[model samples]
Target: MAKTKNVRQTALEILDAIEKNQSYSNLLLNNAIEKNQLPSKDIGLLTELIYGTLQRKMTLDFYLKPFVKNSKKTERWVMNLLRLTLYQMVYLDRIPDRAAIHEAVEIAKKQGHKGIAGMVNGVMRSIQREGLPSMDTISDPLDRLSIETSHPIWLVKRWDKQFGFEKTKEMCEQNLIAPMQTARVNLTRISRDECLETLKEEGFEVEKSPVIPEAIRVLKGNIASSRAFKWGMLTIQDESSMLVAYALGVTENEHILDACAAPGGKSTHLAEKMDNTGEVVSLDLHLHKVKLIRDNAQRLGLGNIRAITMDSRTAGERFEKEMFDRILLDAPCSGLGVMRRKPDIKYVKQEKDLTQLSSIQKDLLGTMAPLVKKGGYLVYSTCTVDEVENQNVVESFLAEHPDFEGDSSFKERMPEAVQPLINGFDLQILPQHIGSDGFYIACLRKKV
Candidate 1:
């Protein structure tokens, strides 16, 4: 049997992985816990500590600034120790301040000298005596948001510019918190009710979503490695993502092209929506991703999906013009819409990536436009809220392809709460407004 690494130690390793190298917090954290054979309770603690520290990094540093006069690399372990302690004090309600301080001091004593340990103890005690830094004292709106919400300063600024102050702050706060585990019911195998019954029998808590019929949101638990998921009875997907395939309104025997499809979540959902009867050609730029699509489809028992490795920009070269009854161009974008799930994108993504991505989106839309059959639907979707990538890309595509027009019936298929967001033809799901992942979907029809 493997010795159990302490949760804090596991968290430290994860932070080191994220800081010293190129590793995603979610993936690395999951891998670390699994590899080390940590207990489930310790796994929870490790997750909270790692995610809390990363999410509140800016805020933690800001609070620490008052304690440390100058931000130099002095006693690195002490800094991380304080950060972990402060994270528990501020965010974790169960952890008492005294316990947090004691843990910090103990860790400090092990890692550094008595002087550094004393400093760590002093800082935590001071924080416990006083409290978190006041968000009001910070005059700069972006800086204030960064401190209050624990997002990076650069990310706060970008969101502030894009979404304005209030909306950006809300979005930042939302990202700091853990997202709910949402799953879409696999209709090809079982009905939503039947799936829920199966889940209940397997000792999983589930609640049906009021907004989406086939969407079920799992409350506060891990289901990624569950037998239900492995058997393809449920797919780990966001509620907003579930809407994408449904937005396409695919029917049985329809020829659908999922341009830029990979990891096959939406493509598989589309196949399920078609009752596994239609030919769903799932295309990806990379062969590995194409295999991923095939793997997902195979696991789900979705036989109608055909995974292909091809650049969507060259769709005309591969397929006949106007051949597909439905085409879903879920283009590649900055991935800003999924910041809640993948927080590191906030740090690494550049504004220049946007321009390049927008170019790719336009090229993809242009190439896939001719593939949609006359009177058939073509849905363009992106997990981004940027105007350039969402509505503007559609506008530019419509400018070039005069034979295509926006499908007005899209609103009819959408939930009541999402109806008003249907701006003209394209639906822009804002992160702040919908409590859903930031997404943009446009339904269009090829004119005969």
Candidate 2:
């Protein structure tokens, strides 16, 4: 007899792997989808189970704590299965609670022995009967907010300190919501209007992104399968991400460097902004990722991109000083900003990672500083809202290097909606502001 595949089982496997820090949510999901070749309905259900459980993990844990008979005896898979079931019971209105419980029991029995199955059934039935513990019971304000929003307590404290209570709460709440699908039009290949018409013609439920003129908000349909995407007319990207090339004040025929570029979203945007007239030398550490950049550029029909596999830290050695007209260091980050789209990120990132990543970000910034030509823009960006990785890194660099000053042209450079969010020369875009990913971008100009 052949073994049957189920979304719950696959979800548990991926969730367990995430707990062990094996791979990222997006990467794992894509791989699993391709491997199983499941129907579209099952794919949607699988996606919902994994992301929903991850998004409400802490809250689900709080609900399960009073129900589980023995914590130490429980296997990680059992715990994840329970989380998956409970998440559906609480969050997914379409799924009946009893149906979710019955599925959990079946999955538990198949994955483990009868004892495990009984335990899972007992816990789930009790949850359905007794109702979850009251949020009011968590006396501490921060503790309550953390559980309610399913964020870590330490992170809540840190963000509450950095952004104040109201904003922190809003950001945390936003993290649980599903991110909108948005894509950028490759203006180099086709006008945004033409791309919009093409996407509409392809039956995509889409509209122009209010955030950026070159981007569109996708309401329905897969952009990957659309003819416009295949024809190099569009690329799926976040509205905030679409702003990096603008922050550079990129102009036609200007040479650019995209340090730490992988998958080349911003690198391609830079090239498009330059109308494919000048070189956009993109660098990454891995050969496969360099190929992703090349593939994307090729798909977009952009010929000005030059992708190479090399550690971005070593980029200074490979290029002469003051070589590029502008440089983009979209540095590696804790990825706390994109949590809405990838809930597993909150679980994987630790506070210590911030300090470590900050050091690396500063080093990358320092290394690439000399490569930006006189008066050229050095646009430092990250998909994170943490102060240590954003402001502190840029501020420290500016203090140590007086030859570079914050480029306030970002006032005119960014879309008007984003100008007021600017801080000095940098902007910290909290995810709640525009339903976009939390992002930080700072423009610096090398003093003439």
Candidate 3:
């Protein structure tokens, strides 16, 4: 009979799959953990190993290069084993170096030859004795920041140029930190205070967001597994994202268009803010995603949302021009801002992706712009910090479409703490500032 793989072995396989197939790390890890039926403790270890190793891939490679000569020539599985083992040694202080090495050697023997096992044992010992090479040797500031933070050098350079050295460094460091599990309370069902009291009664350490009233930050416990979440009293979302509904400032019984809406977090939030009385047309490009939006709405018991599988670029063709009272173009972006939750994005996204995504964002904005009725609100948002995709796109749109003007009054609807962050109609929420996903929101109003 084939041997049952241990947690380390399972983690190595998942990492190997991520490297070989370029699969999403979170999805792959969750599927593997469920398939193996790992215990809670082992599950935690597996998660750390996979995410830590992938999050610091470049740094791990840099540290391994001095020890493992011809690393490129080594088998991909062997290299991943080395990377994950080294990650435990350097970052995870709870696991002893000896135990980590032992596990790696055993996993190596089962997966590879005796020679690979011996090499794994030897390299880990060498790393323990010699320690890692100095990062100070990297002369270029951008290159050093990239290695230290395990972000792509090109991305670091781009951020450096845009946000300057200190802010770029802070953003990179923030990305490496694990994101808090924040959820927006289903205000249509329960008030924020009532939800907090219920969560506290259930022994969860929960706190209301200072900025977004409906947002609750789960400080401890498996929030998704709780009765509150199962009953759809809460929807997992970042505080920054929850603010998009507020930016739209919808009224009761108003018509709202959530262009490019999928999985329906913002759409549901819009419906909740409108007291479940408004019509929220949620559109996505794929049928599967439209179903996902519908599922979320059904879970939250939100009847106001209508999920439609249609491309945002072709929104005007299906809907009457200037039909909606409010239009939200939460454009697809490079996803640089949410890297804390999705570290794999740093490796997968390229420099050219920004230009390509910006073009798509602008096209979506233009397509959805006409759908906002006169005296209606239009809000453009992205989960990216890129200037071209956020500010530049809005600026270019304003230049061509003179009918819409920046709406500064949106700030008045937001928390006073966030009011200072708003410059005219645009607000850029950095992850470090709000301890949430980085987001850019721009509010515009159609001329009456």
Candidate 4:
């Protein structure tokens, strides 16, 4: 029997890898793209198909709910096949409906029995005859958001309760569309203007990010595997993330500590902001992560960064108290902020994960507090908007440690538009409010 190969087939394989086993979407997609030697256009389609299906799983299931009952134990392969067809039928304009149905049946026939193929074809034809499921059918706001936006009900309910219904809906809808690939200009290599000129020369269109001076949003196309990116003219980063290193305000010859730094984006940016003249000790808990930081620094030609494998929770014990002039605690959290970029996060992260991560964040913040010298700066940032992991954690930390206070200087450092969000030094950037990723960054100072 001949095997069929197409974007849909590749997407199904990737989904199976993610569901039956534990596989990162990015890594699996990269491997598949490389192994298949797919054309650039097909590679793009494969990414869209895989990500779109995963991103809208709940919604697709909602549409399929009436078609099949007692679905709790349905075979995952059948479910994924139906979802893939529905994804193309609904989202992709280029792929014709009849073609989508035919491809789906072929895939089903290859993987399952004639009965499964019949079921797949029937359901898709029904959808093509009728329109997609209506929002009115689902009365519960959370359930409606879940089905409409293809997110988990628990997440929708949580957001509705925390951020109001309108904002919750907006967040869910925002995650469906692709995120802009933003990058921070490596001033050490080229100025922002110079980087923009270089990118334009390479046939890349870019627009300056409104939030950060050094960040540029890629408006027209992908730059992940481009020659300019390879040459280190820019590093892909969110505008909010680029602010963390800038908020640290590293100066020449100053000692800096990036506790919990991994993959070293912000740490390398800190070194760059310091003009590569200061010492930036970048530490991560895992050895592999340390290597990642080292690789990023090497690629960017950042010599000022020293990547180390260390647990940040005990940074004060290992490093001298008040030794660093500046410290950045890019604490790990639920990663709710970047949901638009990584759709799998909403499904993978649980409520318990946030609770457990908050405790660790508190401990790490406490342990790293003393590492900053008297009057030195400490920046605490997370890629999440949950109050438990954002404001509440910082408030609790300040209550426990009175010697450190929120630095009002952060307000002065932030752009005028962002300063109002600073409730006396704490900043919470909402996902929908800002086009950038939802990030919470607070600048604290140790009393002299």
Candidate 5:
């Protein structure tokens, strides 16, 4: 029989993989849990340890630095182990500090020499003896916030400039929170009320989303395992993302294009909104991702969606100009807005990535602009709140393309509750505002 790894050991291995291989924390942790076939309690502990360690990495490091005199000299795995241990000690109220220290030492001995184990024991003992350094001592406010929130200093500075210090601080604090699980009801097959009733019947604590009529927030229970999701009655999606298809406002028999569609959440929602009558052409850059769109469509019983593998930048070459009644450009973005779910993003993303992503977003808009029929609706959306990738990209596109103008009337079609959040034709839903992943949606209309 294979050795049964404890939660801390599993967490250590995951943290090591994340640092050594540049693996995503969520993906790696999930893969590990599934591979190990861990029970629910252990899985929960592993999740908490992995995500909490990654979420409070900088802060934990700040506390660990003074103890480990030569942090630079310490092995990467050792540093990660220490970070994981300290994370549990500082944040997890349930786990006793002595237990955390003992586990760290044991894991260190298993992975490294006795000297290393001794080093781990000494460092953890010192931390318990003397509490962490005061953040108030950090004179620079940005540095303090960055360390306190476990965000990169450069990102904090940028956000401070974009939104004032107080607002940025709130946003950073919000990023540390785990987002609520939200699912969109497939109204073509099941009404929102019916879906909510079914979920409740299955013992799930679900509530209607305040922003979108089709969305429901799951307060408890594994929504993915529910009968509603398995039967295609609900789609696991963020409330902010569910608004993209609504922003398009497609009608029956109206052709729509989902440019850069993949994993088909928005495309599937678009088809559902059309009552499964319109031709929804979904395009993706990769063949594998195109298959994902097909799978989602088949599962949802949505026949109107046609999946194709084609790059959005070259969409004009394959598709006729002014062909579709509506177009959705769910552009790729920095993904800063989703850090709560994917804490690894905070470490991997850099300031330079924003410039590169904005360039690609503008290119996608310019490339797909001609595909919209004259006076047709085109919705550009991203799972990010950065103005450079959202509002600025739309502003730049409108400046160069005189044939299209911002559509301010788009809000009238959205749920009444969300109408006030719309700015002109664009909506920037910050995570703190609605407890949803940060997303930006802009609607434009081609000139007749």
Candidate 6:
């Protein structure tokens, strides 16, 4: 279905927009793929080129510096083209050097004059022939790791302080890797075992999720377009995100609230866990996203969910105190844990953003804490590894609200794969841990 010609050119355009227009790589790439109707093979190459170049930007630039005399003076599109070519030369062993170099030269000539085309050809060939510069040349260990791993130095230092130097290095390395495509089984339609058998019969390669019993690891093929997915037997989601519903520990016929729910991933899971007997009041800030939640619920044939368009902060005023049996505050954060999936976060997220996000996270925690009935649980989660967003925010809320205390009972709902990650009453899953997204979940209970 994809236009076979000019695939590399498509990737180059995407890389340029990602930096020039401050566009998100994943979102832009998806839009391009959908708009162009790319075939699966072209999709694979396009995805690899865009993500590999962005994930290893600094490293590729370092390798190209010696060859390009006017590195900074180079045009943005030309720079992007060189980086994409260099990424293939360095990381993609399957792509031969000559083909990559030729394509870069051709793209350069098409997009610019012969002069820039010659320069692009020279840079790519020289890098391939001369080999990359050694990262050891950098004096500071932090700087060396940052450049080699293509992570920002400030973020690296912060993680180094939060999680020791060794752990930070491992986490940074893990962030460059691609995440697995995971899906959750809709138990309302079929059991996990039955679903797995069905998928196998349909020629899909899959395995049970280590963290979530209801999830499966999509080893091959796009699970979203699978027959099971179209039939509403499963939904595409990461095991780490699916863990939230499991941690909520829903049973039949209980009232629950999902603050900041959108697209209804966790809300639907909570409803299914309740066997469609209880109501899951899902709240989102945007009306379109609320519609998306409702659409997802209807697609999955789960009618127990009630989607609402309201900010969680105003939820306190609208709903009675202690109205919900359980509340989930999956607050927005710096999104540091999800860097592997969205590498653009490495360049755009600053230390100031973290501070602002921490404040918002704290506010959401305090606002949602009261909504949980006494003896009920409030789970605070984020797809980030930062201490300020996870531990510090939860600790601040616990101190301010004497009625709320850390709840350990939630662990009973956890699988054995994540038991070692338990810290006091919370669980912090770093990227290196089990190779999932960097996620944090803390459980709090109302004491009075």
TM-score of each: 0.91, 0.97, 0.97, 0.95, 0.97, 0.97
lDDT of 4: 0.84
Tell me the TM-score of model 2. Answer: 0.97
Model 3 ranges with Cα > 4 A deviation = 1-5
Q: Give all candidates' CA lDDT scores.
A: 0.81, 0.89, 0.90, 0.84, 0.90, 0.89
The better candidate by lDDT, 1 or 4, is 4
Candidate 2: segments with Cα more than 4 A from true spot: 1-5
* Model 6 agreement with the true structure over 72-112: per-residue lDDT tens digits: 88899998988898888888999888888888887888889
- In the range 157-222, model 3's lDDT, one tens digit per residue, is 888889999999999999899888899999789998999999999999999888777788889976
As a whole number from 0 to 100, the lDDT of residue 28 in candidate 3 is: 94
| Model 6 lDDT-worst window of ten | 1-10
lDDT of 5: 0.90
Task: Report how far residue 277 has shifted in candidate 2, in Å.
Answer: 0.3
| Candidate scoring better on lDDT of 1 and 2 | 2
lDDT (tens digit, per residue) of candidate 5 on 1-448: 1232487888888888998888888889879978988988787788888889999999999999899989999999999999998988888899888888888888899999899999999999988889888899899999999999999999999989988899899999999987889999999888899999999999999999877888898999779888888899988999888888878988899999999899999999989888999799999999999998998899899999999998889898999989999999999999988999999899989999999999999999999898899989889999997899999999999999999999998988887867888999899888898888989999999999
Clashing residue pairs in candidate 5 are none
Question: Cα miss at 178, model 2 (Å)?
Answer: 1.0
Using TM-score as the measure, name the better of candidate 1 and candidate 4.
4
Residue-level lDDT tens digits of model 2 in 288-344? 999999999999989999999999999878999999999999999999999988887
RMSD of each: 2.7, 1.7, 1.8, 2.0, 1.6, 1.5
